[model samples]
Target: MGAAPSAGRRLGWKAGLSAGAALLIVGIAALARHRAGPPARCAPGMVALGPRCCGEGQRLDDAGRCAGAPSRCGAGLSAAPAGCVAPGATVRIAAGTLRLGPSDWEAQGVVEAREVFVPAFSLDAFEVTEQRYAACVAAGACAALPLRGEPGVPVTGVTLEESARYCAFAGGSLPSRNQLAFAAAGPSSRRYPWGDTGAVCRRVAFGLRAGPCGWGATGPELAGSRPDGAAVHADGRVFDLAGNVAEWAAPDRPGDGMSGTHGGSWTDEAASALRTWNRRLVPVSTRSPDLGFRCAYPP
Candidate 1:
């Protein structure tokens, strides 16, 4: 009976040793495979290449590359998987000049412009919509900016106070005129956001016609209507800030007593009026169909 028990114990030990050895072999094989780089798999598809795995709706292609991964919009900005910027979130861009139209037009005309310095900051990707503004109003965070048309037609006719209120609710602040111009023109004193040329008109949001009465001439379009409207730098910021609604600048001018509006409205014709430095003074109490504002935040 003693011998039988000893034999049984020996058998158990051997079995345990075999199991441990098998597990070690498996682990070694896995480690070797991992060190050899990603396994041969389909390209442009998500796969469990090793310890890491891509999310659903993704696949590894024949080239062993992952495909269909969503884009990243960074902090404070909203974007879809494919990388679509939300209308209200601000986007940062490289520091540059805020160009203004020519000062030569003393009598009255669109001004040719050059670059001015602008500090780094972020700005709303889209103009504030009625739906968004309405939320602020309901929260008592801000008063409503008057609207002459549909709620979705872009909130217009808002005072600087109202604009600032919206920015505050969004956890940002209204940009001063200088800041606004810097965002639009960038470091270069280009006539347009992209450059100093008439061709840039197609890339910005402004009227196709000229003169103060030209307001609403171009009509408000989406934030990025122009193909080359704004360029995203290596740091993931966008530039050439025009082509939606004209935004209000901070530090209210007591002399003119009118807030500054930057970027061209749908009604502007001459490219000169759309320069970064182009300033229009509207009564703080006044709001127009073509007038709207975008908010800014510190980077």
Candidate 2:
């Protein structure tokens, strides 16, 4: 005759089975999480709460979900799955204060370093390309660029008025001097778009060593050809803010008949000329091969 198992033995067996099942469930959950990868990062001015991205003034509700309507995007910007966007391949910049001058260099018209409140706006990621401008011209909104090159390259030799007209046709406007400086230097007021680093062929398309791109290149390469020259912001990247081509900004004073050209062009050889704060005044009607422009949208 065989003896029956004790009650304690049966209980112990049941406990072991339950423990094993629990351990298996935990392991499966960990593996699933690992396979799912990290959670999505929220855009600038938005906070990530679990699976929801809440705006600046939003709050969590009792159910642990984000509550409140998302703040509206600035004028000319529309909310998209990838944050705010403006017409003409632009990136949105949240409204904030920035130091708007160069602390190192002092020039005649250079305003001393001062805190300036910049409103929410959007700026083109790259200078206007010939392809985009050609569309405007074809639609009868803009005149044909005088110095045309590759379709992918920036269109140049447009007067300040011409640039403004193109911007308007593209659903934006010529960025003001302060707006240009804000986008170039950001809130940190970096000496260059990529930081304090000196300008080089890899970082800019200036006429230094050999030429643009340091390979005896004659003129500006394709727009955004110099990726290292991008001005990285929390929102996104703005390319060629310190090179590629000088950009025309709206005159600081209306009726002055003079506009500021900034960001030193491919023909600029001096590193000092490429400084974010470096600018020169020219007659609004003047146009040069190295001068181009991008647009800005209002808040």
Candidate 3:
């Protein structure tokens, strides 16, 4: 038989083994806890929300998982399938200067105002309507728009790529952020396209969840006369420059795969969102039910 260790030596060996075993157990427990956290529990294409999770471009479902589309679409744009069309021709805006940016009274943080010069260009008086886009689809020059909204409303739910295609089909192009601001705010650089009207529905085609399609009304009325009180562009060409539907702008920096959207939408109640200075930079692939665009032409 092997010789036994002395009692003192045996005690020391036993204690060392016990301490090592304790440390190993602690390490295993820590690893298990880490694997059980939210980052681990969530699946691919899902993000963990408070006590739940959501999918990309989707809100939290009742089951706490991301499912379905985003909750906010432009006001008046329904989940229904239909198209929209504006009834007016394009307007020509002469080359002019526009003072863009927030007013001194409204400036916060580092936001400042600047003057922008826009070349002579032609812009549509109204946002592109579903009917206009459909014509392009029929010609096989554009993709079919998703089934939502009405024919008389501003064409919502288009990506920047789609908007560019539509403009090209119409023999025009998308306006730059600076151009849009100039067309809306003019040289005075008013607080809003319609002055400081605050959050009034009359000044902007908003507040109604469903657009003016029902009850003998117009849908997203940009092509023609609105129910009075809507702001006209400072240059006196485009309509609903501050609200109605957000319009896509040409990318400020090309090759960056990024672009900007301007104006306020019907879903927004905040006056600031509808100002001439407001700009939302997003990916070109983005599509929203309340987002649409207008076309511009060089002089």
Task: Score residue 151 of candidate 3 by CA lDDT.
Answer: 50
The lDDT leader among the candidates is 2
lDDT of 2 at 190: 82
Error of 3 at 5 (Å): 99
Off by over 4 Å in 2: 1-88, 105-111, 208-218
Q: Which candidate, 1 or 3, has the higher TM-score?
A: 3
What are the per-residue Cα lDDT tens digits for candidate 2 across 1-299?
Answer: 89999999999999999999999999999999987753333334555443233444555455433345446432333444323323456788877777755465543356566777999899998888777788899999888765433455578888988889999998889998888888988877788888977576656767622533343334454466455568888778888898778999999887889989989987777777788788889999987778899999975
Better of 2 and 3 by lDDT: 2
* Shift of residue 11 alpha carbon in model 1, Å: 99
Total clashes for model 2: 1
TM-score per model over all chains: 0.57, 0.66, 0.64
TM-score result, candidate 1:
0.57
Off by over 4 Å in 3: 1-85, 209-236
User: Which ranges of candidate 1 are over 4 A from the true structure?
Assistant: 1-86, 95-117, 145-153, 198-202, 208-219, 231-234, 237-240, 252-256
Q: In candidate 3, how many Å is residue 250 off? A: 0.2
Cα deviation at 63, candidate 2, in Å, is 66
Per-residue CA lDDT of candidate 1, range 216-255, in tens? 1323433343435564443544433554567777766555
Q: Poorest 10 consecutive residues of model 2 by lDDT? A: 73-82
